[model samples]
Structure formats: structure tokens, C-alpha cells
Target chain A: MIVRPRLEDHLVIGKYTGKVIVGVGLLMVIPLLVSLGFGEWDTAVDFVISISACLIFGFGTQLFCRTEKDMNWSHGLVVASGAWVWATALGALPHYLSGHASSYLDTLFDVMSGYTTTGLYLLQDIDHIANGLNMWRHLLTYAGGQGIVVIALTFLFKGTSGAYKVYVGEGKDEKLLPNVVHTARAIWLVSLTWLVVGTAALTATGIWLGQMPIRAFFHAMWVFMGAWSTGGFAPQSYNTFWFHSLTYETICIVIMIAGSFNFALHWAMWTGNLKEIRRNVETISMFVTLSVTTLAATFWLAKANVYPDAMSLLRKVFYQIVSGHTTTGFSTVYAKAFVTQWGPIGLVVTTIAMAIGASACSTGGGIKGIRMGIMSKAFLQDIRRMVSPESALVSQKYHHIRDVWLDDGLVRGAMTITVAYVTIYAVATIVGVLYGFPLDQAAFEAVSAASNTGLSCGVTAPTIPALMKVTYIASMWLGRLEFMSVFALGGYLWSVVRGR
Target chain B: MMTRTRTLTVLVVSGAMLAALAAPAFALATYPPNKPDSTELINHQNVLGDVTKGLFWNGKAITFHGEAIGEVMVRGDYAWIHLNDDAYMVENIEEGAKLGGYNSGMAVWVPSALTKQIDTYGDYQHEGSIVSIAGVFNGACKQHGGDMDIHATSLRVLAAGHVVVDPVRPWKVVLAVVLASIAGLLFWFERKYRYLLRQSGRVGT
Candidate 1:
């Protein structure tokens, strides 16, 4: 029998939701200070305005819808979904007010992409943009990658029964520590440490590669932070292509691999479990996939006559393959030239890599290797079952920490999400093609944007039609939330609107 | 064991064949001077084909043939030209010296010697008129970093005409429409049959 969840239940959800919004408001102040420190008065003003708006709305919601207890699963889902949309709205204000983006829609798209770590952009001259604004872009990616809610839950919420629900809703599972706050802090610390190491190495490389020392330092810091976080924003207009040196590419590759690793593995490493490196399925899969795709792409580029020599071809191929697989979206080659020259095969291979995505519980986005591993195991089990008789109850198993048997419910849930992911990609691709893009290019952009992979076929330009931009924005939002929470939120909203 | 080995051999061979067939059209490093930095103009005056290959212009690295060769005026090291072979009027030439060239063509820098020859032989005309100039190939130009240009050795008159070409193709439009329609349908289907879509996974037995 169906039962209506009470208003009290919603109020319980609202109280945590209100706290999260307030936390988001507080977080905005850091970027605000960054903007002020950089003397970007306009950006600082915009941040102040946005923060004020967020605080007012958040506090108002808390006051009107007060509750005394923790939230339920349904409430948690609503709050999780609500936070993403609200955060995106607030995030757009700085872009809009600073005049970085021409329209509100473009601003929203940029913000959504930033927070989601999708790396897509509408701004034409990123090189000319101020340091504070650029930092804010990566900051969003770092925040969004770990999830703003996770930050809030860790710092603000104690004795909150909805923590696990919120965690799952934020598209993560498996905590590194017993306390949720400790787990959150550990993830942030590991990420920040990598960010520091990555930034320094990349900066030194940039200076050695002949960029002006000051520019090199800034580029190295921003690019490393973005790349390691899988944020994909480059401080310069040329993205990674501008540096045009092997050293720059190598540093980016290292950072991308680091970003694609699950934080839990990092935690295990920190705790002195050296064996965790070999045991982690996500890391192993990422390495294997990176190797195979890099070699394949290198071979393909050489065969296609795209480059004159094997070494040059390999360089281009490796850079792109790594970029797409990690969903970093920073291209060494011009997208227009790549699309025009390599044809459908190159596009297909890159898109497939993007769709396959990166390691779970990392900044990178897509279907994720963990899900892919789960799907692969399920497929093998089905094949085995078909060959065996009714008496044969062969145990279906896959290794995570250890050999773990999968039950029907778990497998079904994993499959459902995977299928939903593919469907989203397929739909987005069709929309892209319909708006005057080639079939291959359309599919590539759709999957790239939808998976928040950020790779482009030269179609994602400032001049792109508004409808197509809207399509990409929707795809980025849906991809980041992994579809389920968004769907759940929609169901909840519909129920409320219907007065059920 | 023998059968397994045979199967593996066949698979390997097949993979090799596929790789070979799908090989990139251009050979890496085969394109002579694989790095752009190593690109130098080899004197093969009568050579004709794709302009990119024939007579290389250092500043832009683009090669062109046909009627009027474009004129790009220069003073000191700086040169100004309307980008992408666009038409330039004398009044619209900004503050640079005038050189004779075709209307609606890329502007390029010429050596001082060639500029003097044009100044002596030709009458002062609007920058927009189409004209051809002969010149020795300069390896690279200083005005724009990382570009190539030619030093005009002489001037010549080719036919006066404008090059026109359509920008869009029918196939591109058709393909785009089809893809969009498919995307719309999928979105609707997913929305309508969300539960059904959810069940269709490779994982979850």
C-alpha cells in the first residue's frame, strides 16, 4: 500500500537542506576573498551579491520550514538534488555580473560545467581573464567534484541520520574513516596534497618549457589543480595546446592520472596499505584502459596520415587519448582540425573513452570504471548461467577489496544506471546532429558534454546555437548527478505539485 | 593446445590486418619536416597542386595560385592585411604603405627591394584592386610571430576577378537534422519509459 510522507518529514529534510545552503553561502566567501585579493573588484562585488542572495534565501527557508530532527531517505534525495540546482544558480551570478559570459544561460552552463568538472566553457578569451576568476572556476570543480553537500555534511551536520543517504545521493560510496567528517577531511587533504605537488611540478616544467616565469607559475598552478581535480579549465585561451611542448603534456598527463584515482585508495596509501594499489579495481582499470587507448589512438593517427612521423603522431594520439579517457577535456590539438582530418573513427574512439569515463570517487566524470567493471562481471555471469543447467548454481563474483559475490538486486541497480547513462548519451548525440552537426561529431560532442568529459569536436563554440547549448547544459547537470538523484527529485516535486 | 595456439595466431593476424587497413591516410614524419619549426621553402618554382604544398608563404604558411597575387603593405617590421583574403580599400588600409594587389585577397609582407620595384613600375591605386606580384620566398616573417611570407622581387598583372564559394553543404544540414530528431525521440522514450530503460543494463543479473 502507498503512503504519503508527511509535511513533518519534508520539514525534517528542509532543516538539513537549509544548513547546507548556509554552508554554501559561507564557502562563497572564500572565493570572494580570492577575488578581492586579486584586485578583481567586479568579481568580488559579484561574489558578494551572490553570497548575500544565497544567505537570504537559505535563512528564509530555514526560518519558515523549521523542524527538530534529522531527515529521512526521501528528504535526503530532495535536498541533494535541490542543492545542486541552487548551487548552480548561485555560481552563475559571478560569471553573469563580471560579464565573462554574455547571457544568463551561458553563465549557468559555464557554472554547471565548472562545478561538475565537465570543463566546457562559453568564454572566448580565457587567457585574458583575471586570476581570481580563473581560480573560482577550478575552485568550483574541486568543490563540485567532492560535492558541496559532502563539505556541508562533514563540517555542519552532526547527529544527522541522513548522512549516508546524502553521501550516496552525491554519487559516492565507501567512506575511508568511521566518522563521515573524518572521511570528508581525508578526501580533501589527499586531493589538496596532490594539488600542491602537481602544481609545483607542472609550474617548474612550464618555466623550463620557455613560458615567462610568472605566467608559467600561474599556468602550472591553475592547470595542475584543474587537471588533478579533473576540472579541465586552462587559465589560457589555448588550453593545453598553447604550451606546445612535451614537458607541458607530460605534467598534464601525470595530474590527470592522479585526479582519476579514487580518494579511498589514496587514504589507504596514506594509512600504509601499500597493497591497496594493486587491489583497487578502479585504478587498475584506468591504467589498463589508458594504455590500450593511447596505443590504439597513436596507431590510428599514424595510419590516417594525420601526422608525418610516428613520434609526432604518437604524441598527439597519447595526449588526446589520455585527455578523453580521464575526461579532462584539455586538447593538445585543434578540435576543428582533428574533426576535419581524422574522420569518424577518431571521433568514435575518443567518445567511447569519454563515455567509459574515469575512476569512481574522483573528480573525473562519466559512466565510471567501477560501473563498467560491475557490468562486465554481470555479462560473464549471464553467459555462464546460459551454459549451465538448473542444478548449477555457480556463484557470481567480482573482486573489490576482496572477492565479493553480487546479489540480484545490486546487479540490477548497477545495470539500470548504466543503461540510463547510455540512453542519455544516445539522446544528446541525436540532438547535436539535428542542429547541423555531422553524425560522428554530433555523437562525440553529446557524449563528451553529457559525460562531462569536456572534449569537443569544434562544435562547442561561443557561436553554438542556443538550443544546442541548452542541450549540453542539461546533459552536464544530468551526468554530474548520475541521473538517479535528478529523477528522484523530479518525482518528489511532481508529487508535491500534485498535492498528493 | 594446438587449437588454442591456432586460434590465437588467427586473431593476431586479423588484428594486424585491421590495423593496416585502418591505418591513417598520412604517414607520420613522412610529410617531410614533421615539425612546423623545421619547415623551409624548397625552390621548386614550376610545381603546382595544392597551394599548401607548392609555393609556401612564410607568414601564413598558406599557398595560393590563380589570377592576382595579394599585396600586403609593410613599414618597418609591422605589416597589416585583412585576414582570410578579404578585400581592402586604400582608405581602409589603415596607416600602412600601399602595394598593388587583387581585390578580396590575403595581405602579405614583401621585402623593401620588391616594394621599391612596385613603387617605381606601378601607379598608385586603391588597395582593393586585384593584382599579382612576383617575389623571392622569405622563410618567415617577423610581423606575426610564427608565420611565413614572401619578399616581392617583381610585379605582374593577372586577370581581375573575385573568388566566390558557397560555405554550407546540403549533406551537413541533412545529417544534423537526422541526429537531432533521433536525440529528441530518445529523450522522450527515456522520459516515458524510465523504468523500462532502467532495467536494460549489462550488469545486475
Candidate 2:
């Protein structure tokens, strides 16, 4: 006649949650150092306060609750889900203190957006924000792209059983190494290597294109972080258009494409298993979806006479498509141009690309290529079965680490998540529309938020309704965690509240 | 005779008042002529928007004033400049003292000689110069891959910008110190918790 939480439940959650909180605090240290180095006393103080708050809260949970239980699946899910909300709240500290955001809600929105790599910004006066605060914004996305849970796992999470559970909960399914720690290490290694290589490339480009050396280096790093993470932040509000260089755009395009690749494929290709690139299911899926959507948009733009020459068309139109498809949200064209210049057809195609999004186990978001691939294969298999004789044995197979069979459970799971993502996008769209935005523009921004793709047709701004802002924050959060974990969190909370 | 004298005095006063108004207009006319039609200013949004029969704005040689933001992007003999018409500038002129939000701005193409005259640009530490640009607006410029830009013939600094000083507030420092102290207390408790665990020889997830 009574409901109860096991002692171990409280302990395991607290322990790992504490470690994650510590990791969150640790992230602030970078910004703090930046502020100090730049002589931004106010910003430095913000980080100091932020770091202290995170540490106290994190360790407070650990002190109050202690346990020896290793994390079960449920605990991992809870920790992963709960930690995000906590990290986001704490992460908002520096931003809120910097006086850029109009409200705590606004700052929280920015942090959530950054952590989800959603690219929607609520922070006001972005161009005037301190270096440390700006670094924090880009840093959160860079870390978020790679999954902040992975940082906790790599550095703080000591026990393997619990560590692996939390890692999977953060939406990383692949065990890149035999050990969970090793897997986290490998992910960091890949990210850090890309950071170095990509930053160096962009920085050199920045310098050659005529910027001061220090400015060039930092801008390169920030831009590289955004591109490689498929995050849509820029140093200036003008975004990628600020540079106005073909060379810069070309390099960024390359980084976005490379960033959207499956990390396993990266590992395989790096380690001389070059054939893996052709065999990866996510890659094939991306190729088909990207090509189809891209062609459709390009055709519409050309017919409308949006661009005169093929070069300009390729540069402008093709750039938007890739950015959308990758869910990177870096656009060469103006935001309203999507509505006015490209018209209805272009908007539809772009929304499709945004919803489809980038590859799984990579620094991108949305109804990942793997799910789309599975759904497509499942559809084809059903058609083939319907056409063929009933007696004939029929099976579908796809290569993703190896030959993965299209089992009913696998198909159903993929379809369910895909459907959930679509529904969330739709609901957010409805919210946007109800708040007085045009349907197409509302839908565009909604898909952008829910899919973590940050292209806007003018709905996302400071003047947008509070309801709309909250809706977007939820969309980004739900989209990043991919629904199931969030659903799990909701269930867990409901049980805690109403069970007894 | 008295009525006629009174009428003459009234006419004289009215004529003087008219002359006084004309003097300001004459002074305004002395400044370099820019606007093709009327002496009206336009914001970036209006220049890029405000379409009429597919044309954004129906004029050439417009005069506009906006805060110069970021660096003057130099390329060959020409330079690309951005002028911000954000809430800050609006509120600064019309309402508040502080500027907030991402500004609405337009790209301006000017001669290299013109850009060098700017002493300050908008950023975290400094407010940018307010400058008046006499330019032709193009909604879709063919010269720069269909950019909505202004090709400027002349620029004049209307106002110089100064550096902004932002020091850490004492209250913020105090709050930080208090929070750090709480963290210290938590650290002590954590150490005790760890010691108790070590004594028990139990490893937690």
C-alpha cells in the first residue's frame, strides 16, 4: 500500500549527478581564465560566482546523499536527463551575470540552446558581450556537440558499470573502445584533434583574409567550434556573412560535412579501413536525403530566378541546403530571404533537410540519418515482401558497424523516435503559429528549434512571445535528448510525486 | 493712420519670423547635397525593405546615420562597413541609455580612404562612431553576389564613440565570495564523506 525509493536510487543518482555538476563547474574555469586574461573584471567575477555555485550545489548533493550502488539503466537515464537541466541552470549563470540576457529565462534559453547545439540565441547584444562570455557560449556548444556527459565520464566517472549507462543516456550508443573510459577518451581524442586541425585551418584563412593575428586565432577557434559541432553561432550577428569571403565559406562547408560524419566512420577511415566510408548506412542515407532535398530546393530557386549565375547559385543556394541538411544553421543568405526570395517550395525543402538532420554518433542533431535510413530500408523491405511470393524468405540488411539486420524491434524503435521528433516539431510549430507568426515561418523556426537546426525566418527574437520562447527551450531540450530519456525523466518525476 | 501703422508692424514681425525659419533651412542646404529627392534619412531595414513594385526603396543618394559596428573590412581599394541601427541607438536617441539586442545593420561599401577616418567601432568595451553616409541603396547588389548593400559616395562622422568602463560590482564580488565559502564548506563535508567511505572501503558509482 506504499511506494518507496530505494536508498541506492538516491545515492547513485546523487553520486554521478555530483560528478557531472563538478564537470559543469570545470567548464566555467576556461571562461574565468579567459576573462582574467582579457582583464574583463566584471565577466571574471561572473565566472567566479558561477563556478562557486556549481561546485557547492554539486558537492552538496554528494554530501547529503552517499551510496555504494552502481548505476542501473534507470539511474543512468535519470542522471543524464536531470543533469542537463541542472547544468543548463548553472550554465546560465555567467550569461545572466554578464547583463546580456534580459531575464533569467532568456539566459537559460541560451544555455539550453548552446548545450543542445540548437543555435537559437536569446542573449541580447551578442556583438557587445565580453570575450569570456562569448567563449563560454561557443565552448558549451563545442562540449555539447561531443556530449557533456562524455566529459564527466572521461574525467570523473570512475566506475565502469555506471559510467557506461550514463554515456548511453547522453545519446551516444557506440562503444568505441572495449572500456567505457577508453571510449570516452577516444571521443575526446577525435574532438580535440578536429579542434586543432580545424582551428588552424580557419585561423590561417582568417589571417590571410586580413584580420589581426589574435582576433584571427580566436575567431578561427570559435567558428571552427561552431562548424565542427554543427553549431550555428558566430562572433557577430551577421554570422558567416560577416566575413563575406568565398574562401572562408568553402572551408566552413568542408568542416560541416566532415563534422556530420559518423565518429566510427572517422575512426575506421583514420585507421585505414577506408572501405567503411562506402559501407556506413548513415552515410548512404545522408547522401540520398541530402541529394534529393538539395536538388529540389536548387531547382525551385533557379526557376524563381533567385540567383543569376551557377556560381552564385551554388554559393548561396547550395550553402543553405548543406547547412540545413547538416543542421549546422550557417546561412549565406538573409533569414527573411527564405520566405521572400526562396518562396514556399524552398522553405519546404529546407524544413525537410532540417528535420532529417545529420548522421548519428556525430556532432549534429535531429531525426538522425540512422533512423531515416532504417525507416527507408524498412519501407523498401515491406514493399518487396508485398510484391514477392509469400513463401519466399525475405530479410533486409544494412551495414552500420557491420551487417545489421532489419529486425521488427529495430524498425519499430527507429520509427517511434522519428515519429516523436516529427510530432514535437509540429507542436512547436503550432505554438509559433498561435503566437501570431505565419504558418510557414512558424514551421521553419519550429523545425529549426526541435531539430537543433538554427535557421530562422524571423520568429526567433527578443520580441517573440514568452510562451513561444518557453516552447522553443523545451523543443531544443527534448530534441537533444531525443525524447525517450526525457519521457523517462517525466515518468520518474511522476512516480516520485504521485506514487505514494 | 494708427490702424495702418499697426498693420505694417504686424507684417514686419511676420516677415522677420519667416526669415528666421528660412535661415536654418539655408544653413541645412549649405551642407553637401546627397538625397536625390527629399532631405529624409532611412534606416537599414527601410532601405533593404519598404518594397514598392519589387523595388525596396524608390530613391538614390540617400542620407543615413547609424552606429559603425565591428571593424571596417578592407579589401583592395574598397572597404565593407556595417552600420548598426539597433534598439540601443534608437533608445539612446529616443528612450534608454543602454543599448541591447543584436542590432539591425546593413553592409556598406566605401572607399578605403573613408574607413580610415573612423576612430571607434561598436564592441564590448567601446561604443562605435555615429556616422552619416551618403549612398545609393541596392536591395540585391550584383557586384557582391546579390547582397543588400549601400555603395557610399561619402561619409561624415556625426559623433565620436568612447570606451565603456565595466568594473566588477562590490556586491557581485561579495556574492561570489559567499558562494565560494559555501563551496569550501561543501568541500569539507565531501572530504569527510570520502574518508567515511574509505574507512568503510566502499567504492560508489
TM-score of every candidate: 0.71, 0.90
TM-score (C-alpha, index-matched) for candidate 2: 0.90
Candidate 2 residue-wise lDDT, A1-500, digit = tens: 33545677877788788889999999899989988888889899999999999999889988877776678887888899899999999999998888777788988889998998878887777767788988999999999988999999888876567788888888788887779888888888988998999999888888777676887888899998888888888888778887778889999999998888878878778678889888889999999988998789878777766554667766787788889989888877667667766777888899999999998888888999999989999999999999999998789999987899999999999988899999999999999888888888899999999989888876798778888889999999898888767777787777777766
lDDT of 1 by residue, A1-500 (tens): 33455788677666667667767777778777866675665555566666666665566556556555566677777788878888888777767755446578888888889878898888533433445677678778878877888888777777455687877677777688887667777887887788778878887786665455765676787787678768787764446755545777887888887788777777878889878778776777777777877777666655655454556666777878888998888886545544644556677788888988987777788888877777777888888998999799967776665667878887888788778879989898888888888888888889888888887767787667898889888888888778777887887777766644
Task: Name the runs in model 1 displaced over 4 angstroms.
Answer: A1-5, A212-214, A385-393, B1-205
Q: C-alpha displacement of A16 in model 1, angstroms? A: 2.8
How many steric overlaps does candidate 1 have? 36
True contacts kept of 1: 0.00
Task: For residues B1-205, write the lDDT of model 1, one tens digit per residue.
Answer: 9999999999999999987654322221122221222112322111112335333333333333212222333444433221122112221122121221222222244444433323211111122222344443433223222122344434443223322221223543454355445434543543445445447852210
The first chain of model 2 has a TM-score of: 0.98
Clashing pairs in 2: none
